[model samples]
Target: MFKKKVVSLALVITILLLSIIGCTSPQAQKQEENVLEQEWKEVIASAKGTEVNFYMWGGSRTINQWVKGYVAKNLKEKYDITLNMVPMDATDFVNKLLGEKQIGKKEGTIDLLWINGENFKTAMDNELLFGPFADNLPNYNRYMNTDSKQITTDFGFPTKGYEAPYSKAQFIFIYDQNKIEKAPYSFEELIAWVKSHPGKFTYPALPDFTGSAFVRHVIYEITGGYEQYYNLEDEAEIRKKIRPALEFLADLEPYLWREGETYPSTIAQLDNMFADGEVLMSMGYDPSKATSEIVKGTYPDSARTFVLESGTISNTNFLAIPFNSPNKAGALVVANFLESFEAQLSKYNPENWGALPVFSYDKLNDQEKEELADLDLGIATLSQEVLDKHSVPELPADLVPIIEDEWNKIVGK
Candidate 1:
């Protein structure tokens, strides 16, 4: 009887242990399998013998040449993809694609774009983009935060990863460092400097992003906040608060380029004048632009970039595939490469072309940053520390048009 009892108790304990093990083992296996599948999916197969037509802003010859270099080397060497740059005013491309959509031409003539702001919003609204495909890129998992998703979500849209952020740009001031003893650290100080120097400072006219950004920059400085300024929509309230900003511009009109009657036709003209010693300062989106110009003998080597003490603004530019793009997969492959750390580093290396990278550098381990840090960046570029001092500017959807019209009226043309 004692032996029987002992045997029965041992059997019960054995059955319980087996039951627990059986339950947990399958769950563990399932989790491991899911992770393995994800890892495998991330290794995108290269698109061989594919041609991608990249539609980009071709306003600058240097940028166009650089894109050609990308085609001749990077895409061909790695993915066996061919790149053709389709230069058009970004608006023209948008209109063409929209027309195609109306006529039921689902497959598009263009594959990629260097895009942001209103353009991005328009594309998203039309449901004209390729994928929530960014996740498939191996590098996507390493980003610092997913709130970068906010960019897609807030625009009354979904990203589906159809767009991959490629580079970052900000409104920055370029000054002749040899002549300007100390760069103005704040908007107030900048005003003071201009007053003292008289006719030495000016910004581009609106309707241009670079020019419109100047208004946003000033508004952000005086508003003392970002969210409220970005969300402001009430026309009356907008005009009321914006009055101070507009008045500031009107007040400074006497000291502007060509006495404010004729501002530089575009940011490019302003940059050129700054290069020629015709002006004391200029503004640019690509912080490395002035440095690049200097290298090309378009500007003097003494120019330096600075952010106001009030802080400048930053926003990411992205590459997106139009939904109608027949070569969707190829475009994704190219965009993935463009957003890769290797490509971004090369493009933004200050000396290389100096567009700030959109990828979060903080996610890069110390070793990666250090490896990238040693590249030969150009002189007069902002150091990493100085660059970090600036803030991202998010302008309201309606604001640009209002400011542009107001500027046209102010300019009386």
Candidate 2:
């Protein structure tokens, strides 16, 4: 009789617990949690000892060295993963992926690549990228500010978790402090200065990265503002709206270097011309580029960087996994490692890459915050406060190629 009563009481307790919780028992819930933990472990286990092929633009020596040195070393130590960084233009890689997709290739040579703006849009549109996988990164969960516009959007298009924000860049004009007492503060001031100083100023010709950025800034200041262009996708309509900015460029052309007959073909050439004293100012998308050049002894100590009072445009670059990557597991681990606090800190140092980190300052713990605060961003880099104060969003991606093509016809011709 006592055993029967004890068994009946246990059955009643089980029924009550299940009724309260609507069906899941405590043991069942625990098992589900264990399965989730196992899944994460499986991902890590699969990534170990694999080689990840990372494709990126091979334009900067400092960037190349940092990747081949610091990044490669840490990944090998932590995950036993071999990183092979392939240097190539982002467009070429995107096109490569498109070719793979068209042929229904199940595997591709690229594990990951760097891109932003239109290139990223093209990849997403063509379904050439892997996953909404950014949320899967451990470091991304802990350190990233996903709520921020800088992370969620690239050039007015939603990222939708397709890529992880890598670094931040803003446009700034570098000038010889010894030559110009004050950098131009507005389009009007810049034009006046250009007219007075003949053959002393010229941007890199269109189709160049930094050169296109300079044109975007001109559009922002002259044709109202950036927000207006986000929804305006019509090509002809955009041309009409930007006519004034073009006229402004045309009016200043004759005073440009080489009498506006030609322009520097690249931002590097423009920087070289400035260093050689052929032009008074050089401009680029990187705020710390002047600092990097000075450190290399290519630019004089007199070099300084400044942005327009109307604010310079800023954009975020990202890393994405290719759709057909044979090593998706390796790519995930590598990307997670890159977003770690250690990698971000190294990339921030001028001795390394000197690019702005994508992590929010508030997300950092006290020690991490102190480390970031201690980095000497070099003499030519602007204070974060100033850069933030004058920072503007980039124009929509679709509008960029239009600006480039039209500039070729009007300003370049």
* lDDT values, one for every candidate: 0.69, 0.84
Q: Clashing residue pairs in candidate 2, if any?
A: none
> Candidate 1 — what's its lDDT?
0.69
Candidate that scores best on lDDT: 2
Off by over 4 Å in 1: 1-43, 46-51, 58-65, 80-89, 106-110, 143-145, 148-160, 207-209, 253-265, 272-279, 350-352, 407-413
Per-residue lDDT over 350-412 for candidate 1, one digit per residue giving the tens place of the 0 to 100 score: 534567766665677787688667866678677554665565555656666776776575542
When summed lDDT is taken over every stretch of 10 residues in candidate 1, the lowest stretch is 27-36
